[model samples]
Target: MQNKKLNIAFFGSSLVSAYWNGAATYYRGIVRALHNRGHQVTFYEPDAYQRQENRDIPDPEYAKVVVYPATQEAVYQMLEDAASADVVVKASGVGVFDELLEAEVLKLQSQNCLVIFWDVDAPATLDRVENDPADPFRAHVPQYDLILTYGGGDPVINAYAKLVAKKCVPIYNALDTATHYPVAPEERFQCDLAFLGNRLPDREARVEQFFLDVATKLPEQQFIIGGSGWGDKPMSANVNYIGHVYTKEHNAFNCTPKAVLNISRESMARYGFSPATRVFEAAGASACIITDYWEGIDFFFEPETEILVAKDGAEVAELLQGLTPERAKAIGEAAYKKVLAQHTYGHRADELEQLLLTTPRTATAAPSSADAFVS
Candidate 1:
């Protein structure tokens, strides 16, 4: 495969470490991988809060950070910066100025640039578009050259197809091995089972169903929960809640726990193949993972070998009680090996490059005309 060195401009919520959003890690991982492959990347972040609180990761060495204002001037500036880039990616869920950013990115298509609508939350986005046909983004989807999602399998592809996207690809969440690896166990995070995920409305119920229920059932065992929006929840004495853990502390949290729990959001579990970034991160750190049952498990890992699938709180209890330390370590090792082999950002970047190469590119970008080609 011929490697093309493309100038890519990436627009997303916030890269500033202070914001501490999970997408920051996603951007850093993929952007760094693209840079390693010799692509020039420029990242645009318009969220002032993220810029103010940015502490997620250090400024990426491989990419240039362009902090744009959350104003009309910022959109104009973004247009000027993105005009000459071969590819301009607008990632979904950028906290601030995304509506404005999306409008500007759509306008850039007429400049003959390859624009990609990269959705991190495919389920949410699809749901929103389905409920409202007159959404501004709905009309723009067909105009964009490609649609990429962070996770979701067939459901996401089908959703994009409904929007008349010329091509849609699911670039599933992957681990950055360099950032996540086995570490010396820490006493603070020691527990029989642990789960790390930010609290979101769609995921809150699953967290209750999988983690909280499991904690309630296994009152004798120590359980630790990490992530934001979990502070107000009443946790059992056995359940230790650590509000929000930073990325750098991820490995210690993974290594300290005997077994880590993976509770997929309602939509992701239903869709299958929708492994969150935490799955790969835990695997990369060689943490034994017991995940809730979802579709397409075989494609990622073999049940009973590389991973343990749980149906509900009772199943989670069964695993917690039965899984010995040695067996847990072996499972973690197996998962680690599997991830290193097939689920790394490097691998995802390769897949993305292939998709981009195979897709037809056009020099003209008139919105109505572009829609005709995509449809």
Candidate 2:
């Protein structure tokens, strides 16, 4: 896919801020890799003032960042940009005017351009659209040329097919090897177990079951939580709650933990194969990762050898207590090697390019399971 100089236009939430948005790292990684491959990319984001102020990067080097208001003029300008690009992608959960963007972006479909609906949280988005008959974007699924998802293996593709989506593909979360490599451990983040994620309604219960419960069961082990919104929650004496860890601190935070925990949101877990950005980030830092059982785990890493899996608090305690430092290091190294080989942003960029070039102009009415990559 090298030297495939295509102009790509992307519309999504803050690419500069990791404040409340989890897609920042993914957008940065994929966009940078695409640009490095000689594609001209432009990212359009709404004037989400708070996210703008809390941005880790005020400006990104890879893509031309364009912040637009929700006015009529801004909408027209955005459409113009999309119409001119070879491929235009409207990602889910943009935090503002997402319904409008999804419905209208399909209008840019033409012989020279392709329009895609990129679902970052496929499970949540599918739930909303499938359950709610009044969902405005329900009818627009078939209008776009292709549907791309961050995660959700066959479950997501099949669900979109039910909605008569033309074509659906899963592009799971991958590591940015250059940005998320090993780093020296920081004293503040040192702990036996660590879990980092924003406190959201769908995830807090799982965090309690997987993270907080395990912490309570093993009183002697040090557990750390790094993310926003858990401040008011009850904490055990051995547990440490750091309010928020910016993107720059991810490596140190991952490196400091003896074993990092990955607790998928309930929806993602139920659907299976939906790996959060934390999985790749932690693995890239060569941290021994212990994640809850999810389908398609084998697609990314070989469990027990490359990664560890735990079903409940008892298992979590057992794994944490059983592994020696040498064994843990070996597991982390194996996971790191697996991600570098098949689950990096560079790989995703190549997949995207191939998908774009190969997908039919007129998508089939029913989705086929033919186009899928496990990593």
Candidate 3:
């Protein structure tokens, strides 16, 4: 995989802004790791969703960023600019002109170059295509040279294979130690339990059950909730809502809480094997985490030792009942050691680099894989 540096062009949501874009941390970690490996990357993003107005970072030297107007002509121009790269990637949820970009990127496929579709949210995506027969993106599944997912493990792999995607790989999330490591606690973030995630429909119910409900059960315990759109939601008197924690503040947010909570969205919990970025961020901060029970968690973290798993509010309350600061610190330390050893974005980049080096380079296709998928 480290044989030679490849020129890569990436199209996705904002790389410099976490505003309304949950995949920003993921993009930065993976892209920066690839850069450290000596690969050159040019990132293309649309000027939409007010991301430019509320950027978490300035133009980074790791990747060349090209922000284009959200117009039809800009999509075509971006494709033309990326055509000469050794490998071109079109990531999911770019916010504008995504359909056009997804379909047209495949047209650049050739013998000397490879085109890939990287789905950052496979659980939601697979679920969407599964329910909708007339989905336009469903047809483009087989056109890309390979399908790469940020999470979703074997479930995602099998789903994509059924769609007859020539190949599918899961590049699970990991810590970027440089960005998300331990930080000194801040007074504003100190609490018994802290949870941070933007408000989305698929996740709100789960958050209510796992976080807000748990807060109600233990009225004596102080709880802090961060991220966008929760300011209006009713919460227990013991609960504190801090709106929209930025990427730079993630470490403090994780560290200040006695034990942070990680609740997956409904589709992700139903599909399993999906660990959100919060899990790693907490572990990196050496902050104990109580994550909702899901499949494949043990593969990443040892339950009851490295991490605490709770299936419902009752389970979370019980776990909190016995959790002392000393015990919490021990669990946090163990989780940190484990993730640093196996689950950082550096590790994910290595996995991706290997897959790219081994995948078939020619423009090719598998049969329409929607065979099992549609049924």
Candidate 4:
């Protein structure tokens, strides 16, 4: 007999566009892809921030959005909603009440609901839990039926194994082909080089080292920076800052730049194979890319032909100076082709489907009759 289509509940922090975080984009892409594949997805998020502010993309049609409060009653309501789901996923870093949500999800697992703790910020989560003996998530890891990550390849695998996750899969960041692809350059975003990333402690230094420092050395080039929390930073006249470009504008931002800059976070850079969403975004837009050195990069794209890798500001300056526009465009096109062929939300959804099929369903807790449904 064919297996029944699973009812899936995706619990993340924010589904609103105003948040405009990488996690929001990842959720939007993966959940939308899953819905396209005929899986029933109910997305749960808190209405802490009005998502309409600076909204870029329209609300998703495929998934149902549930806004919950920050109390135990809300947790109970979430569990009730997830009771019929074959898989209940608690995504990491859901800003407001994620800890409570995770606890409730874990409790539901005791009643036979399959629970997944999807870690978007694997490195930071692992580091935080590892350092604090009192961390609640540390003890709960082993209870989760599956662990999924957005990035952090080997290091994440090792860390989860140590934590005793039954199955840990790194569902790395991928291009949302429908949203990100080649487009005509827009005048507002036109620049010789552009970098888009939010401010984070681990990533700030690398940004300074690779992006800001490089800008100072290349006074002749017009560089652009796009993301949140850089308004206070002193910038050179040659470098322009565009605050928080939305998902809809990513293509224009990428296509308008001669080359886009990518700097991996400290843990991701150390673990390798952990390409950020921006790498695929710029590549999908057929924009030339210059990235900082990271191990296992060759597995995704050819260093010189598909994408340029720089070790420091000096290497960045050299690539900016030496690479011809034609050659850069050719490289961008190559990377774009590679990304469309191998890395997209469609591919990720397929991988996730396979993983779900292969993983043994936990039989410890069975859903109540009213909480179970047939597709």
Candidate 5:
């Protein structure tokens, strides 16, 4: 337990909104736990008004929410906040001012504050940085005191280390058992297989391969896709397309499906050990899950017993056809037990606290200018 109450400043996407941003759940779970432990947290976000309006939470009780305009004044205010904080975290995919925030927040490390670049999408960020010589973030990588990632495991850690990152830690996503547990199945999400994810370029092809293709293979089985940007995708007769399932409905959505499908983005799958939030959410609902094969999966859950793995659409179809109700129930139960025991946000909060406590807070050379952040 932390003896002193630390004032943490988090600059990230809308904490109150689940619209478009995938990190809301991650932020909520971890930040809420920290708040529970008697720490003060202030969350800063840009006024992406649409997301704000569609917010699941207008105001988050866990942190002081500040929605600033995308202006130079706002940038300066954010920097001031970062400089004064005990631990300042700039999470990736802020949807606005990401580059500016990353560069400016790194500058706060000189003031003896622990500035961390928390990469929610590590593989995508790594790909852009390593592959693109013009990537802006490459130069800024080594500036932060510590780098924490939601996923990407060793590949991300090793890649960032090569970039001269001071220290890198992979803080994988975990279940918030309190909010995401087995609920009675709902009728709206009832289907043989269900998937919930916003369509992004990196994940679209994999979804087609693992979800749509498999749905086609098993035409007799009812399939449902619940997410945004997927309305444009063509669907088979047996497939139901429920555009976007709100945060409140996730449990019902997870519970309703006989077997939920988890299709990782190409980068995430290649990087491995990157279980999407959907995996844990569905498991919390005790829904049988069938996921595409990815590296280091055994690190999270035992593949055959706790979860099902599919190599291709044919394999997905085979699993769907062969998995008995009893076997599926057993797998779901096993996964739930595993998550409750080892992979909850409470466990992650402890790890995060330990990391912050142990990490050396030595000052690094200051960044040249905001323009230096340019790729």
Candidate 6:
């Protein structure tokens, strides 16, 4: 079975839309890469969260997508079809019926099938279980055949180990070369520095400290902030709020900026080794990237050369003050080459393929109707 082309069933937020789904890029990249490597993938997503109505792309040829209703019956119907799949993935944060899905996916586990709990936001999940002893998911963690995380290095792996997980691995985010690459600069996105991330509780304060604070220091420089939920937030006049940019415009968004910014969520920054998908996206677009300091960034790109690192808003201001277009281009080129060579989704897919083949399956017997979830 080492080289077997297994069938993979992915239960995620949405594969065809990114309206409010932050993990859409990560799903598209890895799934497309896996398809290219000859595996058959079937992505199942709930129709909740208005994702179907606001789809960014039609059904992709790479994976067969099944968009079911948000009702409990719909998940059960989907699980019946997923039972025989070689691998079944229940991702974190499906928006609706998440707890139901989390418990139900494990019922498909058997010697012939691998059931995985793929956490797109491992930092937040770990924080929750660590703080709450009665967290329901804590009991379910050790039962899965394998645990895969979006991007947490040692901190995440060890945390799972403490929960007695059979095996836990990190499948860090990566660039999709086909979808994210250099493009002609767009007038609307052109700015001194740009940041694109949805508004979230853990990230708001950091954004203030990094992007908004830096903008205050450089009153003359132009800045643009894109994403949902910042339409009314007060900010420096020099900073423009572009609001929710589509993925199709991502390359231009990154390329047009003199330098793009990346601010990790509070948990991710404290944990280290978690690089946001935007880091690779900007690097793939050959945009000079200025990111707030976090542990393990150097593991991805050489700082001060391939990528610029800043300790705080003051340091970010200083970096921007010194950055010239020519120097920015040189740094962008270096980053583009590095990511293409080592950090594309193809590379990540290869690692995942190996893990799937090597990780020993230690799941319990198939669940009975008596163990059915109560929703």
Q: What count of clashes does model 1 give? A: 7
Local distance difference test, each candidate: 0.82, 0.86, 0.88, 0.82, 0.84, 0.91
TM of each candidate vs. truth: 0.93, 0.93, 0.95, 0.93, 0.94, 0.97
Backbone clash count for every predicted candidate, in the order shown: 7, 0, 4, 1, 0, 0
lDDT of 6: 0.91
Best by TM-score: 6
Candidate 2 C-alpha lDDT tens digits along 1-375 = 334588999999978888888888998888888888888889998877478778878777788999888565675567665667878899999887787778677666666677899999999999998789999889899888999999899999999999999899998899987679999999999889999999999999989988898899889899999888999999899999997789989999998788899999899999998998889999999999999988988889999999999887678889999978898899999999999999999999889888877666543232111211111
lDDT of 3: 0.88
lDDT of 3 at 224: 95
Which candidate should be chosen as best, given lDDT against the real structure? 6
lDDT of 3 by residue, 5-121 (tens): 899999999999998899999899999999998899999999998999999999998999999999887777787778778898999999898888887777667765788999999
lDDT of 1 by residue, 99-218 (tens): 666766765564446788899888888888889988888888887888999877887899799889988899888888778999999999999999998888878998888889888888
Worst 10 residues of 6 by lDDT: 366-375
Per-residue lDDT of 340 in model 3: 93
lDDT of 4 by residue, 1-375 (tens): 025576788888776563546677678779888888788889887655555455666567978888787565665667777877877899997776777777667655633356899998888888888899899988889888899998777878999999988879999788888788898899998878899998887899999888888899889889999898899998899999989888888899999888999999887787777888889889999989999999878878999999999998789888998978899899999999999999899999898887765566666666453453221
RMSD of each: 3.8, 6.0, 4.8, 3.3, 2.9, 1.6
Question: Which segments of candidate 1 are over 4 A away from where they belong?
Answer: 18-20, 49-51, 110-112, 365-375
On TM-score, the stronger of 5 and 6 is: 6
Which ten-residue region of model 5 has the weakest summed lDDT? 366-375
Regions more than 4 Å wrong, model 5: 364-375
